[model samples]
Target: MYAAARSMSRRVAAAIAVFVVYLSLAPPVFPFGAVVVHRAAAQELDDEGEFSYRRDAGNGPARWGVIRREWSACAYGHLQSPIGLSDTVAGLADRPGRLGRTYRPAAASLVNRGHDIMVRFNTDAGGVLVDGVAYRLRQMHWHAPSEHAINGRRYDLELHMLHQSADGNKYAVVAQLYRIGRRRDRTISRIEEYIERIAKRKDHEELIDEVVDPRRPVRGSTIYYKYTGSFTTPPCTEGVTWLVAQKVRRVRRRQVRLLRNAVHDGARRNARPLQEANGRGIGFYYTSPAHGMVATGG
Candidate 1:
C-alpha cells in the first residue's frame, strides 16, 4: 500500500510541474473584443519618384490619393502646419483706393487668452489706451526665423496675436515680425524675464502662466497683408483667416539667442518652408486701399 501511494503522489507532482511549464511558455491572453491592430492611409515623400498609384502604399504622394483606415497611420497624412501670418494672405480681394483714416481708443477689456493664468491690458489707436472697438484677445504664441519673407528676407522672431469674433466664427491673426536690432522692446523684456524662469524648470504648463502681461502695450502699425491658409500642424486643415502686419518689430539679438537656447530641441530654426500657393490669392491692406495679387502655385 505504501509503495502504491508513493507512485500516485509522484504522478500528481509530475502533472503539476508540466502544467507550470505550459503556463510559463504560453502567450498572454488579452481581453475579448479588443482591437489588436489599426489601419490608415499615410503620407510619404516620394524620395525615388516612382510614379504609380498602387506602387505607393499608405497615404500616397501629393499626386496620388490614398485613404487611410486607421487613425495612427493616417495621422501623418493629415494636413497640419506651423502658425504663420504670411500663409494667411491668400485669396483675399483687393480694396482699391486710399484707406479711410480712422482713430479709435483702446478698450480696457483686452483679455489675454494665452494658455491659462489670464493677463489683462488696455489699448488705444496710437498707443496703449482703454476703450475702442473690442477685439477679444484669443491666444498668443511664437514663430522662429519669421514666416513673412520681405523681398526674400526672413526675420528672427515673430509673434502671433490671434483674435476671434464674439460668435467664434470669424477669425483673424495679427502677426508682428521681429528683427534683430540694437533697440530692445520693453514688453519683450518683461515677458523674457519670466520665460527664463520657466526654462530652468522645463515645465511647459507652469510656464504658460508666467509669460503673459496685459499692461504691455500692443505696438506696430495696423497696415497688414491678409490671406487664407491652413494651420501649420498635423491635419493641416485649411480655411483660416490671416492678417499679417506689414511693419516689423525689433528685438535684441541676445534676446533671440536666449529664446533659441532656452527652448527644447535647442535648434534656433522652427519656420517651415513655403508650400505651393495652390491657386490662392494674396491680399495687401495698403494705406490707400486693399489690393489682391494672385500667387503662382509653388
Candidate 2:
C-alpha cells in the first residue's frame, strides 16, 4: 500500500509538470479576448498616437485607408485633394471678384504638427469672403515640393490657408504655389525665425508677440482656380472649397528649409501624392470688372 501511494504521488507530480510546460508555451488569453501583440511601445505611440499617416514606408499613402477604420475615404473617396490641374480646363465667366481680403495684423503661434509647420492665428486674425459668404481664417500650413500641380508641373513649395464659415459646416482652403527665387516671401521669412523653437515637438504650439498679416502671401493675386474637394490628410473630410491662386510666388530656399526642418528634420518630404480628378471640373477665373473668372466642374 505504501509503494502504491508513492507511485501515485510521482504520477500526479509528472502530470502537474506537463501542464505547467504547456501553459508556458501557449499564448496568454483572457476571459474577453486574446492578448494583443504589440511590436514596439515607443514606435506605436509616436506622435502621441494622434496621426498614423506617413509619406513613405509601411504607413505611407497607400496604406492610409487601412490604418484606421475612419480613414477608409482616403482609399475609396471620389473627391481627393492635391489634384493636378489640366491645361484645357473649362473657363468660367468673369464676375466682380468677391474674394474678400481684409486680413488684419494679429498675434499667431508657430507649431510643429508632426506632418507640417502650421501657423495658428489668434481670435483677432481676420479672414476672406467668397461669393458673399464670410469665412474666417483659422490656420495655415505648408507642404514641401508642392502638392497641387499646374499643367502636370509641380512647383517648389505650396501653402494652404484654411478657413471655415461662421456656421462651421463649410470649409474653404486657399492654396498658393511657390517657386525658388532670389527674394523669400517676407511672410514666410518672418515666421521662419521661430522654427527652431518648435522643431520636432509634435503638437507643440508657441505664441509670438510679433503681429502677422495673413494677406502678405497673396497680396495682389485676383486670379485663381476654384474647386470643391476634401482634406488632403487622413479622414480626408470632404466639402472643402479649394481656391488655388493663378500666380506662383517666390520663396527662398532657406525659408523652405526652415519650415521643412521644423516638421520632418529635413529627411523626408511631406506632400501627399496627386489624387485622381474623377471627372471633376475646375474653374479658372481672373478678376474682371464684370464679377470674375469662374470655371465649371472644379
Candidate 3:
C-alpha cells in the first residue's frame, strides 16, 4: 500500500513539472492584440477628430496615452515605433530573400479619415508572411513628413500598408518612404484624384469599390528594414511588425502637398512624432544592385 501511494505521488509531481515548463516556454499571446483587427476594431483605428498631429495641442501625440484609459500603451509601452532607421542601431535579424508577400488586385475602397486618406480592401486581398505566420492586407494609408526616418533623415511622405494576421491577433505594417522629386509616384498617381474627391466630400466616404492591386513597385522591395514596434496612433498597440524599405522612392512635391492638404486642419501634417528606440535593433535585408539579396550582420 505504501509503495503504491508513493508511486502515485511521483506521477502527480511530474505532471506539475511538465505544466510549469510549458508555461515558461509558451509565447505570450495577446488577443488579436490587432490578434489584431476586426471590421469594428479597424474602424476604431481610423483617426477620428479625437486626435491631433499638432505637438502643442492638448490632444496631440504627447498626450495620446492620457487622452484615454485604454491608450495607456501610447505613453507607457516600451516597444514603440517610428524610431530612426539607422545602421548604427541595426540588429542581426537578417533573413534570406525579400519580404514574403502574395498580394494581388482586390476590391478596395478609399476613405478620408480626417487625419489621412486610407484605402481599405473590400474583398479577399492577399497577405504577407512573417516568421511563417500569415498576415492579411487590410488597408493602406499615408503619412506626410515620413514617420520613421532613415539614418536620421526624414522623407517627404510615407505609405503604411496595415495587415492583420490570419487569426486577427497580430498586426504588421509595410512602410515605404518617398522623397519629393520631379516624377510623381505611380501608386499615388493611381489614386490622387480619388484623394481629392475625399477632401471635397462632406461625409469623407467614397462609396465606390475599385480593383486595387497591392503588388508591384509596392511589394517589389529589394531591401527592407524589420523591427518590432507599435502602431503610430492610438491605443498605440505594441507588438506590431514594422518593415520599412531601405531604398527611398520618389514623388512629386505637389503630390506630397496634396496628401497633407487633403486632411483636416490640425492633422494636415499627419505624422506621429518619432518614439524612443528602447534599445531595439533595426534589421536590414539589403538586395541593392551593388549587393545582391543578402542579410547584413549586427
Q: What are the TM-scores, per candidate, against the unseen true structure?
A: 0.53, 0.78, 0.77
lDDT of 3 by residue, 136-252 (tens): 999998999899999889998999999999788999999999888897887778887788888834347674445788785474566778889999988899999988988888889
* Model 3 spans > 4 angstroms off: 1-48, 91-98, 200-203, 217-220, 286-298
Q: Give the number of the best model, judged by TM-score.
A: 2
Q: Flag the better candidate by TM-score, 1 or 3.
A: 3
True-structure lDDT of candidate 1: 0.47
Candidate lDDT values, in order: 0.47, 0.78, 0.80
lDDT of 2 by residue, 15-129 (tens): 9999999999886677324324333433454433535335555566776776666988988888899798854673533322446666888888888887888889986678877
Model 2 scores a TM of 0.78
Candidate achieving the largest lDDT: 3
Candidate 1: tens digits of C-alpha lDDT, residues 1-298? 9999999999999999999999888865653223232211122323322222222233222322223222221234322223333434432444411222223333322122121111232443321111222345555556567755654567888776655555566545556678889998675575665555544233343333333443242344545565666544223445555556667878898777656655444223545444555445555553332232222221
By TM-score: ranked, best first: 2, 3, 1
Better of 2 and 3 by lDDT: 3
The reply for model 2, stretches above 4 Å from the true place, is 1-56, 92-97, 265-267, 286-298
